[model samples]
Target chain A: MYLVEKLGEKTIELFHSIFEIVQFLLLIFLHLVNPKSYNPAMRMVLTKQIYFTAIGIIPIFILMAIIFGSVVIGVVIYLSTAYSLESEIGSIIITFVVDEFAPFFTALLISLRSGAAINTEIAVMSVNKELNTLKEYKIDIIDYLFLPRIISGIISVTSLSFLFALIMLGSGYLFTFFYMDMDFNTYKYLLLNAIELRDILTLIFKSFAFGFVIMLIPIYSGLKTQNHYTAIPVSVLNGMVRLFVAVFFIEVLSLIIQFF
Target chain B: MCENIALIKAVHENMSISEANTLAVEMLSMIGLQKIAYKRVENCSKDELLLVMFIRALMTKEKSVILKLPSEIIGGLFHIENILKDMRKVNTSKEIFVCDLVSSKAYYKECECHIEESN
Candidate 1:
């Protein structure tokens, strides 16, 4: 009976969180289409958020992508060659790197870096009552704060996922050239023949979904913080954990959709 | 400093940045603190903070302004008159009310503004 009660409590808590997220998502989407939400201050914040989330991380992101991409692509090539399944190499790379790994990996890196920062920033702002100051002045928080961050998250993930995929493909060629004695034309022809419009669409859709939740979850969790300084860290921790879970959940859902 | 003061008007009223900025500077000059126009909040003295808060209060569309516990912002009973003088220099027509403790009533004795004491 005690175990049943605990399970019921946990289940109710989960639904409550989901209901809150959906409500917040609806609120954001409504403001997103409202012309007035993109006032001068919001435009300024959007530009700053894009610069901070996407541009600032580019140099480091590129280096990490090259290092990580080379290893993953190199292993894919090496394993295919060892099994004498080199004819299937293009399809394998397309399936693993293009359709799945790139977007998933990019989302994880961004959630770790920018997601945590945003969560903490919002949490601190809430505790300090800076948001209250905005409220008293009739400035909309959704327009001024939440929308810009969420929009930037979507832009960053979609663009960076494509960038990551490109770098990985480039690194794939290097591995095939030096280690597998494959030429550039053969590799290019292989990938082109294996690629399809659907694969590209899936990548785009998956990135958009991933990006939306990454920022949305954190901002929601941050706002859930109690009106105390001690609540800030707890809010961030919960936000980050929820962010990772949402990332994996999206990835799995995409996989299921692809299967059907 | 100017952005903080102009933010509400700029955001709420959809006023252009330059227009809001111009208004903020004019308000600062009215209070004789135009030189600190670009200074950050932390760099300003207590009196500057109080004056800036006063300007922000005026930025709202409301006709009357309330200064709840002015001593908390300006830091003492001794400087209340000077703060009141700074408030009067600004060209706003908004009515200003100074709410303070009965014990601090002596501090505003020399000022021309009206004071209401609450039990």
Candidate 2:
């Protein structure tokens, strides 16, 4: 009987989570459909979000991408050479680096950094009655708060993922030059030739979806926080965990679709 | 049927950039807070913030406005009275709902009803 009750509770929690996500997405859709939603104040907020999430992290993101890309390229080259399958280097790099690692790493970085911050900030606002204060002022929270963050998340993630792919691919070429007797032009040719239109489109779609989940999960968790101070940390933890799970889920789904 | 209705809380209000600036200056001067009118809200004292919010709510030409007084400022009946007086000057016909922890019947002569929360 206890086991059945726990299962039922879990099922209900899952349904609630889905409902919250759908509700948030609906709000974003409504904002897009309404021209009145756009204002200078919201534009300022969106620009700030993009700056903090994408532009601010560029230095660290580039460093991490370089290290990871070099390591992956080194391993791929060593393995391919040992097995005498050197010709397939471009295909392997395209499949692994461009299609998978770029979006996954970008999502992970964003979720860990910006997602946690957004979650904690929103949670604090909710707990402090700031959100209630906004309501009292007859301000639309959706137009002022949610829409800007949502648009920022989508734009930042897509742009950052593209930048990550470009930097990593360049790093791979530099590693090839240092570790092996390969020309930069040859490596560039191989990578560019292997990348197809479908791969680019898939990468874009995955980044967009991952971005949506990153912002949505954090915002949802933050909104769940009540007036209690204890709820803030709990909301942040829940948001981060859910964001990572959603990222991996999307990545796996994309891979399956591409292969099958 | 004013195009904008505002509930005054903290320092946030719904107004165009130009209107907000103009109103903020005018209301600050009216409330004897002209010196700190342009300062960031985060730097303002609780009383100052409350005064700003009161003025913001009053500036709205809307038919109905809601003003939520933070619990900290409820004891300041003098400030509340001045706010109501200033509001009367702006739009005598506009209906105002002042929600606070304390009953403000003594300070506001125009208030028609008092609604208390039952614990």
Candidate 3:
């Protein structure tokens, strides 16, 4: 009976969290579409966010992409050749690396880095009453704070995913050249032939969803923090855990959609 | 420091960035702290923090300002006279009201601002 009660409470908590996130998403969408929300302060914040979350991480991101991309592409090519499925190398890379791995890996990295930072920032702002300082002067916290971070998250994830895909595809060619003795023209032709419009659409949609939730979950978790200093780390932990769950959920959902 | 004052105008009033920054600098100059325009919050002295908060309050476009326990907010020894002198230098028409404990009423006795005593 005690176990049953605990399970019921967990289920209710899960649904309540989902409902709150959806409501917050709707509010963000409303503010996103409104031009007035892009005041100078918001624009400045958005620019800074983009620079911090995207541009600042580029060198590390590219380095990781090159190393990870080479290993994955090398393994995929070796296996495909072993099975005498060399002709299908392009489709395999597209299906696995571009459509599946790029956005997922990028989101995870961002969630670990920028997402946690944003959670801590908002939590600290709340605890310090800096958010109240803005409120006291009629400044919209949603416009000045949340919207910019969320938008930057979306932009960073989407663009970085595309860049990851490019890097992986480039590294795939290098593997083919060094190991398989395949010519650039042939490799290019194979990739171009295997590429389909749906793959591109899926990448975009999946990246968008991943980006939205990564930022949204963290900000939501941060706002959940109690107005105490100790609560900051707790909120960041909650946000990171929830962000990973959301990222995996999106990836799985996208795969299921592709399967059908 | 100045951005704290400028943010309200930039966000709420949709003012341009440079214009808002210029206005913020001008306001800081009013309190003779314009040199700290680019200074970060942590590096500020308690008195500067209090004045920055005061200027931020003034940015609200409210016709009157109520300061709730100014000395406690500064978190150190401060004279109500100096703060009032600074406020007067800013030269705004806003009505200033200082609210403090009745026990602390003696502190504001020399200041030229009105004080509301509460039992």
- Give the candidate order by descending lDDT: 1, 3, 2
Model 2, A1-260: lDDT tens digits are: 99999999999999997887787778778886787777655665688899998999999999998898788878888888789878988888887877888888899999999899999989998998878867866667887778788888889899998998888888888778887778988998988888898878887898889888888889888998878998899899888888888888998899889899
iRMSD of all candidate structures: 1.2, 6.2, 1.0
Model 1 agreement with the true structure over B1-119: per-residue lDDT tens digits: 89888777878788877788889999999989998889997799999988998899899999999888888876797978888998999998999988888989899999988766667
Q: List the residue pairs that clash in candidate 1.
A: none
| Highest-TM-score candidate | 3
DockQ of 3: 0.82
By descending TM-score, how would the candidates be arranged?
A: 3, 1, 2
Taking the candidates in order, what DockQ does each have?
Answer: 0.70, 0.16, 0.82
The DockQ-derived docking category for candidate 3 is: high
Model 1 spans > 4 angstroms off: A1-12, B32-36
The per-candidate TM-score of the B chain, in the order shown, comes to 0.95, 0.50, 0.90
lDDT of 1 by residue, A133-209 (tens): 88987889999999999999999999999999999998889988999888999999999999888888988999999
Which lDDT values do the candidates have, in the order given? 0.89, 0.76, 0.88
Better of 1 and 2 by DockQ: 1
Q: After superposition, how far is residue A173 of candidate 1 from its true place, in Å?
A: 2.2
User: Which run of 10 residues does model 1 chain B get worst, by summed lDDT?
Assistant: B110-119
Candidate 3, residue B49: the lDDT equals: 79
